[model samples]
Target: MEHFVVSARKYRPQTFKDVVGQQAITNTLQNAIENNHLAQALLFTGPRGVGKTTCARILAKMINSDGSEATSEEDFAFNIFELDAASNNSVDDIRNLTDQVRIPPQVGKYKVYIIDEVHMLSQAAFNAFLKTLEEPPKHCIFILATTEKHKIIPTILSRCQIFDFKRISVKDAKEYLKYIADEQGIQAEDDALHIIAQKADGAMRDALSIFDRVVSFSGKNLTRQAVTENLNVLDYETYFTSTDLILQNKIPELLLQFNSTLSKGFDGHHYISGLASHFRDLLVCKNPSTIELLEVGEQTKVIYQEQAQLASQEFLLKGIQLANDCDLKYKTSKNQRLLVELCLMQLASITFDGEKKNSKHFIIPPSYFKSKGVAPIPVQRPDTISEQPQEPISKEPVTEIKEVPEEVQKPVIEEVVSTPEPVINLSITKPSKSSSGLSLSSIKKKKEHLIKQMDVIIDEEELPKDDFTEEQMVSVWNEYAQRLDKKGEKIMASILQMDVPKLRDNKICIELSNSTLKVELERAQYPLMKYLRKSLNNYDIVLDITVNEEIEKKYAFTTQEKYEKLKEKNPNIELLKKTFGLDI
Candidate 1:
């Protein structure tokens, strides 16, 4: 059997030109080497798998080359000394290394020492090697590479030329993977490679490692499904499916999809975070200028654009917010899965049209119902109530009217003839009462509907303004208050009975102890005013409420105040208090 070589090691960059995604660093090194300005001590620092060690080896080999084809093939391994600082991070090791630094290269003009994970060296070892590192032999060159630059001492940093290696970008990584697939005679899908690159997260070595595993799992025919399955990653299709379900307002299907994802052993955190990114990507696809920001295969980009068209900016923004909130709360949430489920449900409801989700905030235009062949219902009120009843007309045979559905009654009401009585045609469509269990949103919509109904203005000039005494108005007001008491609105009833109504022209003014009562009475005034108008036959009557703090002082709210009131009523209370030495 032929020995299998991992793509990471097999396709490693051989020269500066072959290095991926570090052109700036590579060019600088090459230029320095060409000009003989290469630092004797060089520190290469960055994240893992981003070519710190690889570049060191390449630089070491290139420094010894004479630019001839023959010398180019020579790796000059004899002149290069590699050390793993993690395993040999002691003062003794530093002493031995410094001892070696004194010896000149036997094969090359300059000897190269490459130390990997240099930050692992102990403080003592670092101190021991600082002198040699600062003043190395003319023939010795040291290259230090570390993932964590902060751990290295500042003195050592000051003595070396630092090169910051950046993580490989997804685009560059995907293109490189494509080249590798072509070289290996493998048929790889673009989306499959793109996923691999994304999974690598800007590390070329990791990308190559993932590519090898995926290729081994799927053989020569590399596909997106095989890659995702091998990597145990949620595919782009999962998020696409999720987004589609949310856009369609399919909560059940979205939850089922989430369950399936969880069943596949994915973390709820991962799912929610990916969903947020999916929303962000969709938002990016919304505009032509931002399409380049989406890092996906061309096919997936087109799919994103299509989905973006289906999602409104508002929906996408809100979807992202909800998904992100779920992500942030996932770790702290005791019921993590439930938290994610709720987030998904909210996302699905973002674009929901059923039940008039936004009815509390927005009223649907009447034309909307008219467009659907429905007419507004007109409510009629008698302009004037006759003081005396008319005698019954000679019994004429009357045609019986058949009962019809409310839907049919709507159109019939629209066609009603204009009479002496005024008709109010409400333009706002009334939402049907939900038979489902109570919810705050439903309660809010009902309250808002009632407020809107009360807001409908009736012409005061056309209404009856019959003159009535303050006594009659007070009687009707107390009757309404007593009715409210029977109906369990004791707060409002108490507010009404706090003071008698004082008639000022058509206005009935009532003073209360505080502003809170005023607000409550105002909110409940619609029903109260309706009752008073109907009873007194005065549609022009209005309620005026005011708050007087003095009203609160008139009534004794505390024992001391009651004692003071008693003393004011009779001087004997004060004399009794002096005789008994009462606490009051």
Candidate 2:
């Protein structure tokens, strides 16, 4: 059997028209040759496997072939000189090349020198080659290729014609692969070729190599399933199924699917990152103009559009955010699997009701009334039993109590029972202490009358007026600060502790350090004033707060000022600074 050659070397482009994804550069070079406007030195810079060296060789052959198409590589072997600078990067190597440049071409009109990885040349070598590059022989042409143009000195760049080659696009690579498959009589699917293109990441050589590997593994027929299995890539159906389950709020199914995926030795972070990308693709499909941005096969694109119709824009955006956040936190979390599960739960519950339930407080029992010897007297209705004594129901509303007279105040409780027609409201009060032979019904009537009388007295009561001293006001102010501290308001407590209350014109004035303190004190003014009045028996007390600007002026202006202050507090600081010879 004859030796087998790899696809990368066997299928390399020979003519300018055959180069993929580099039309602009090829067109420029060809036009320059056809018009006889070729430069002495040319620099080709770009990523690897982008047809830089190949273009250099093709240009060299075309210059000697009178701009004619040269399909065979052996046509220009005599005039073309290829150098690997990675091995021969020294002053001697450059000296030998410059010596060769002085001689004329034997087989062609011009000699083309092609240097690969030219950035690897030593500084002395580059210096030695600069003179020849600036003004070369009339019969010599230099072509330098490098992946890193920045490493080349500016002097070298300014002396040559520069051409930047871009990476091969996926569309171009996939079409080239299809042509090759047809030539080889192999059956292939669109999705299988697309996978190979994506795996190449804009490198034509890499794509061809991957295509050859898959063919060797899956025989003559190339299928999507075979490509995915061979490359160990997660299937597109995995992401589609996961998204459908999340949209339907099927948490259990999603978890089981994730578990199954993990069992196959796939990383959780990769899965989540892929999920985020899937969401991004869905968002792109949301708009008709952006549909082309999604890079997938035709069938996969249709599936994405159908799913994008079901997923709301807000849901898709939020899902992307959640997945990205989970991916970032996955490496730091101790329980990685639990974190992912929790994220899934939160995503599923995003549309749940957010209004929390309010806790209900139970009412105090009626045993207090019974313990005070007060029984609830029930007013009999016509439909009720006639055996119990009939008590007349009072038709008055209950009022707030102030002070009840001894003559009418009685310990009596009324129980309201539901009758066939109407519900009677009742009142319960303290019972009488004397043996006055008062029945339950009469005591209930007296309690009701006294409750109304007390309301009238309270409405007519007078307000109290008292005076508090400065010391008493300061004492109560500090007490309030302690209370705030106990309630976990440390900043408020610190504000109060740092300021003191002053007496002015029969009123209390509160002094604070800054505006922040003033605002905090203002929020609690009402409650604090109420507490002070009840404590000091002075309801007419007044408080005025002002920020003292003079106090804030005492702060340090610079490091020197702070050091001086420290020196005043500790004289040994000066001695320490002098010993260390410190400067401000």
Winner by TM-score: 1
Root-mean-square deviation of Cα positions for candidate 1 versus the true structure, in angstroms: 13.1
Q: Write the per-residue lDDT of candidate 2 for residues 1-584, one digit (tens) a residue.
A: 99988888888888988899999999999999989899999999998888999899889889899545454555556888999999999999999999999999877689999999999999999999999999999999999999999999988999999999998888889899998889788899988999899889888889999999999999889999999989887888999998888776666778899999999888888888888899999999999999989988898899999999988898888888888999999999999998887777656544332222121211112232232354344444456434677457556523333454554334322212233344332232442343221335456777686445431212212446577777888898889889989999898788777767787865777777678878988887888888787788866676788888776666426788888889899999999889999886
Q: Would you estimate the TM-scores of all the predictions? A: 0.68, 0.63
After superposition, the stretches of candidate 1 with alpha carbons farther than 4 Å from their true spots are: 70-76, 359-584
TM-score of 2: 0.63
Clashing pairs in 1: none
Candidate 2, after superposition: displacement of residue 46 in Å? 1.3
> How many angstroms is residue 171 displaced in model 2 relative to the true structure, after the best TM-score fit?
1.3
Model 1 agreement with the true structure over 450-476: per-residue lDDT tens digits: 546542334456778788899999999
In order, candidate lDDTs are 0.84, 0.81
TM-score of 1: 0.68
